[model samples]
Target: MLKSNFARFAAVGLAAAALVSLGATAANAAPVPTEGPLYVYDGNGILIPTAGHVFDWNDNISASLSATDMAAPFHCSADATDSYTFLAPQGQELTRSAWQAYAPNGFTAEGSKDLLAFTLSPYQQTNGTQGVAKVNGGKWSLGLACTKDNGVNYASSGVWWLPVTVEAGTGKFTADPVGDPVVGSPATIDLEATTVPVAPDVDGPLSLNVPVGAKATLGAAALVNGLSTSTGKLGEFTVTDERALSKKGWTLTSSVADFVNGTNTIDKKQLGIKPIVVSGTAVAAAAQVAGSATGSAPFAELAPLAAVGTTKLNADLTFVAPKDSVVGTYTSKLTLTLASK
Candidate 1:
């Protein structure tokens, strides 16, 4: 009986050992260790996420300065402030000192072709989004110089307007991966919603000097031909809107009161002087030039909004002085005003 009991006990112990070996094998056969989000490297790269995923850096930000800011002849500065709420998931630990910088490829003057850059600091965050990262100090300050040609001041030089945009490829951002392998679209710098100020400029002065001895009914071509003799060539007044369609359209208002010499004034009707816009065989009324633009008459519209070059318009006065008028130096202010429409 004792021998039989020992055999049963040994057999039970052997079965228990076999079960333990099977459990070990099963544990070893399990799948290999998989990395978790804690140490993940997403292929999409890092994201400077804005509200609702709308990357409208241009639309969300605005740059403004007093006309006085750009009124100086040599240099001037204006303050520009913009606020946008952004969320940086992978950048939770990022501090205000850990700022990001971008090199805008086309934010340069049109003539000098000088490029510009700006920096953004993380100031506030909500949930995962920051509140306000003021681009203050001197970063938002603009250094501009007044340009003049032949006693005429130029407001814009093409380099300051037309808002150069960037999206994914036009610009880049700085980054640092502290913990896990963080990735982002650092190249995706959107400018579709942003717009910069443009200084519209008009060049060429219209000066007509015809003696009373000259014949009546002076056509545009004749006036230009005669004036060309003294003022090189009678060129059209070139209108340039570097801001283009980024803002509202502009207008060219030409109005003349009457010829005046000291206290003497030439009656408007007697002068018979009207600015006429003649293109080929199409002749339009005075005040209105180029095409029959929308809004009001006599206002030229800025079409082909994407165009960067200048548009030229030829204007001349139809002199019909009375044959019996008194002889004296008659002068009138041919007022040409350019304003945003």
Candidate 2:
């Protein structure tokens, strides 16, 4: 019985060993790969590169006209033939005739194709004060159709930037002094003149019987931003003592306590109420009465800096009549010039 048991154990051991050997052989076996051959062409579509990248069309083209193709710049005829060359790779299995065969599917603008063309229309474009000529027509895309070794049809395409220009429109150049309150489209400020009556009675030792005074106000600068330059300036206020009855003397001054930019409020003690000494004049030869005072004052400095809005300047003129002097009409010309800096 013991012998019979040993034989049965040995047979079981052999069966187990066979199963382990089979598993080992399976793990050691090499895997087989399945892959197809890769085929490539000389070029995506057209083998030769086109000449000329950017084209600048001259005045010959008109904005009013529209057509399938343009002349000269593009080098392509209006008929679309002979303008561009269409050639296939030589000595290759694929010929221009077999081009469609490779691509069983048809060619489309977006799809694979043997040939393609695109165009853009002319439109208006503006850059600041500058005007750009109508773009007219531009080629957006150019592509050629080709066939692969397989049954699939493909297209090699390219995009180009074709900028054509026409005669540029003219631009305007202007310089103006705009006040806090804008007057016109380009902007204007008013520096009006007014006359003030003085008390006849003398107040103190240095006082006189009466004095006829004229007031001139300064407006905002259109182009002058409180800076002085050749093209423009902040502003200037000139007074020409054209004809004054009194020969004794006259005084010119400002009401601005502190000439500052961007100040909204006109200070009672500063703006229209301050005292400024006015001296200097380019008196006219004919109007130069003996012992008469005439001069031009520049208000450009009173203009605020970098202030894009309006500003104000008040100029006061006083005529110091000689005691017991002639009493005729006293007149003067007040000129205010607001310039750009």
For candidate 2, the per-residue lDDT at 87 reads: 16
Instruction: Report the alpha-carbon TM-score of model 2 versus the true structure.
Output: 0.16
lDDT of 2 by residue, 1-341 (tens): 11110000000000111101111221111111111111111122211111111222221111101122222121111122111111111221112231111112223333223222322222211111112222222111111222222312111211121211222332111111111211111323456798632334431111111124544433332222332111111132343321222212223322122222343322122111122224333211222111233333333332222212122223333223333333333323333343322
Task: Find the candidate with the highest TM-score and give its number.
Answer: 1
TM per candidate comes to: 0.25, 0.16
Segments of candidate 1 deviating more than 4 angstroms? 1-235, 245-247, 269-299, 303-308
Across residues 38-96, which tens digit of lDDT does each residue of candidate 1 receive?
Answer: 11111222223221222222222211111112211212112111111122222211111
C-alpha lDDT of residue 16 in model 2: 12
- Model 2, residue 34: distance off in Å is 80
For residue 332, what is the lDDT in candidate 2? 30
How much is 95 displaced in model 1, in angstroms? 82
